[model samples]
Structure formats: structure tokens, C-alpha cells
Target: MANTRPLVAQWSRLGNSSIAACKADIPRPALVSYQTVRHASGKPASKDKDKKKRKTRNTFRQYDLKHAMQFSLIDAMHYIRAFEVGQNPASAKYEMHIRLSTLKNGPVIRNRLRLPHPVKTDFRICVIAPPDSKAAADARAAGAALVGEDDIFEQVKNGVVDFERCICHTDSLQKLNKAGLGRFLGPKGLMPSAKTGTVVKDVGNAVKNMVGGSEYRERMGVIRMAVGQLGFTPDEMQRNITSFMDTLKKDIAQLSDRITKDIHEVVLSSTHGPGLTLNGEFKSANSIPPKELAGPL
Candidate 1:
């Protein structure tokens, strides 16, 4: 086929009048019309997004480390209980905040332990297992709030995360992974995993253990958890506190590559109450030095 000549002439060969006429004929691009009517739900555009939520000073409660008053565990419990008088029993919980002498970049302390007196007894556990298998039967018998294989996966995919804890039998691990329920359960920290000890051979034992247990992990060198409720007696509070301390020490020791872990400070407080500095006698018999564990050194 013969080559076709270009239709338009080069701009350089065009006369000034022709160029002017072409420029006039060329339609000017329309101005971009922004949406002037702002929607009530839309976030307003702002320049300094980072500084929007920033605070110039620390406003939250800051404990005094220099002259901390050491209250005994029982005394601290009593002090917190006093603040709970006539308050909602369900909301009155004794919380323990342990400040570990570890750096933010240091190894984390994470473990699960059965509290002597469970802070809360209503544990809604969900078990992932074959619907007709013995694991499911055992899980149901052990008081699982929800148990099923495909049904559980479907519910999770639909964002129906009604349960607080989740346990899976080893046999269902592949099926669970294939379901791709991580997006739904991962953020809630309810996905069954071997690391969390939720993936187990015995579903019944796992359910039972989690029902009466509590998991604690150090975040920013601080471990915080609700230890007991206001309904717990003084003795129960003491036992729960002691059990937690013992479990924490034991978990650190059980590490394959052991490192010296120190407890910097122990503070006991309750909901709607002041934080009382514990005397740090919980680690009195432990290997940690009392001086370092008592207060800021």
C-alpha cells in the first residue's frame, strides 16, 4: 500500500494569521469545577493533619516516681475497694500495672496463665473444628459459646466476631488458613495460632484453660491487666496478685535463651480510683533486687 501523507501541516510552516485562527478554534480546556457542596460526613481537608491530634503537654495521670508511697498489696486492695463502694460491681476491677526494667527494643514478655481467681468468669470461647468431630463435641461440652468448622469460617468472614476467645484443633489448621479469616480476626487478636497456644490437639482442654485464664504481654516495657474484681475478698486478691507475679517470673525463666528481666515498679489500682504504688514485696523472694523493683532507680 502507498504511504498516506500527514493531514496537518507543521506549526513552523503556518502563517501568523493561520496560527492565530487555529489557536482561537482550539477549544480552551474547561476549568476543573471542585465540589463546592461539602457532604456532612466528609472530613474537611486540612494541612497539618499530624498536629491536629498532637498535645503540647502530658495531660493523663502521671505517677510521681521520686517520692512514691509504698502501699502493701492488701492495703492497696483495700484502698481501691474503698473507692468502689456503691459503684457498679461489674466495673470495679483491680488492675495491676507492672513496669519492667526492659528497653522498648528489648525482648518482649508474653505468656498465658490461669489466674488463681479469674477476674471475669464470662468467657465466650469459639472453637474451630469439624462440626461432627469429637473435638467439636468436647469443645461444646467444655462450654464453648460457638463451635463449627465451615460455619465458624463463614461467620468470621461476615464479620460476626461475637466471641472473645478462639481455639482451633490442629486438624482444622489448614482449613482455617484457607478460609482467609485473618483480616477479620487478626486485628481483634482472636485468630487461633500455635504461638498463642490456641491451636491445640485437645480442644476441650484448650477451651477449659482459656475460660479461666488470662493472657498478659509486655507493651513498651509495661504489663497491664485486670487482676481481680471488687467482689473478690482480700485473700482472693492477694492470691491472684501473687499468682500473676509468679507466672510472670516463671515465663521469663522458661525462655530458651534466658536474659535478666527486672521488675521496675508495681502499681495497683482500680477503675475510677487512684493508682497506688505497691511495696514490690511480690518479688521479695525472687531473684530481682528489691531496690530496683521498688521504684525508679
Candidate 2:
């Protein structure tokens, strides 16, 4: 009985010491805190608060051709002049915008026309012909500003294309193609080609035709070109317009093969003016009321 009592007392003391050591080594979770942890509120997040506010964009208002009013050639010119009040009368040009009822992928309508009163007189034409040859001399006499063969090609290669128009004689067309100047001249519409009538057997006649003449081309089913200066008389402007429209119709009839090149609408505009649609016959003085411009002028 005495041995049993001692054994029980020693076991109880060991258990009590082990329990106390365990309690001292363990830490209470309440002492540790997380100050960086975020809590969900009904308000927006902190990241959203740092976002930038969007700004309102400015816009320019322009005249829409869909809502344009049809006017006679003379009336349209006068209206355009009204818009060019503060601008130079001589510097402002009369532009014709012709919309064709043709496919965007249709054949391009490109040609040159000599107006009654030329819109511009300062056209620098470059002629590709043998230097000091009869063709070169004739080109110079016909108002070719630059006339040469190898010299002109070298100048073009050096990126010194000082001419606005280019014409190549049939004999020099091969040389022009071999010079690889198309990379430079094609984009500028200065590459001489038989399609555009810039390639010819008669260099002098071609140069004379190009000088003071306006070239028009179809793009996206529309052909736009400056017809005359805004300072031209309405009669002169009418004649120019007639010559151009007649020539355009004739060219379309002659050139169109797979697709029709019918003109759907023709709009007249100035450098800084709104486009006005042409309603009356291009060759006559017939007047039409402004369908969109309703108020008193």
C-alpha cells in the first residue's frame, strides 16, 4: 500500500508540470492582428478611385452632300462666292465633284481637258526624249520646262522631280520603263502612260495639250477636279463646265466596257464653300430653286 501511494503521487506531479509548460509555450491568437487586410463596404474600391475621368471630345460641323440643295450653275457660283467673303477671289478655285453610278471596282475614268479659261497656267512638264534631238527641241518649243533622257532619269533617281506633268515619246517609253522611275513617278500621277495619254509619238503636241489643262480621274466612283478660278465670270465658268461634262459623258461612253460609267450627281463647290448640286442642264442658263436653303439669302 505505501509503494502504490508514492507511484500515484509522482505521476500526478509529472502531468501537472507538463500541462504548465505547454500553456507557457503557446501564444494567444488575440495578440496578433492584420492591419493591411481590407473589408468590403458598399462604396467603390480604392483602385476605382485612382482611375482618370474621361474628357469630352471636340468636333467640327461640315456641310453634308446628302442634304445639299440643287442650284443652277450661276446661282451655285454666287452662293459659293458668298461663302468665300473674306478669301481671295483669285486664289479660290471652283471645284466640280461628280458622283458616278458605277462600281467602286469599275474601270477608272482618267483624262485631260483644256478649259475655256484655264484654272492654272504654271504647269511644269517634263519630256522624256533624246537630248538635243528634234523631238526634244519641239517639246521645248511646245512649253516643256524640262526635256532630256538620261539626265532627267538621273535627276528623278536623285529625287529631284521638279516637274508637275510628264510626257514620254514612244521611242523613249522603253527607256523610261527601264529607268525604274515608275516607283517614283507613278504615285505622283506623273508616270507617262498611253492609257492616260501621257505617252505619245508626238511629244510636242502632247506637251501643248497638257499645259494649262486640268486632269480628272475617277476614284471611288467619283471624279473631282478644279474647273476654274472663283474669280471667273459665270459665263466662262459655264463654258468650262459644259466642255468638261460633255467630254466626261463622251469618255464614259467610249471607255466603259464591262460596267456603265453613268454620272448620278454633280456638285459644285469652292475652296472654302459648301457643295451645291447642279440641277439644270450644264449647257443652259435654266435656274432651279434651292431645295435645302429655304430662308432669304
TM-score leader: 2
The lowest-lDDT stretch of 10 consecutive residues in candidate 1 is 1-10
lDDT of 2 by residue, 1-297 (tens): 332343345445655885765655544342222111222234333445546544433222223456666787767866787898778766888899998876555578899899888999899999999988899999999999999999999999999999999999999999999999989998988899988888888899988888889999987777999998867776677789889999998899897376666677898998899998898653235544333232222
Q: Give per-model TM-scores.
A: 0.70, 0.71
Pairs that collide in candidate 2 are none
Per-candidate count of clashing residue pairs (backbone under 3 Å):
0, 0
Q: Which candidate is the best by lDDT?
A: 2
TM-score of 1: 0.70
Q: Supply the global lDDT for candidate 2.
A: 0.78
Model 2 segments more than 4 A misplaced: 1-68, 281-297
Q: How much is 251 displaced in model 2, in angstroms?
A: 0.7
lDDT of 2 at 264: 77
On a 0 to 100 scale, what is the lDDT of residue 129 in model 2? 94
lDDT against the true structure, per candidate, is 0.75, 0.78
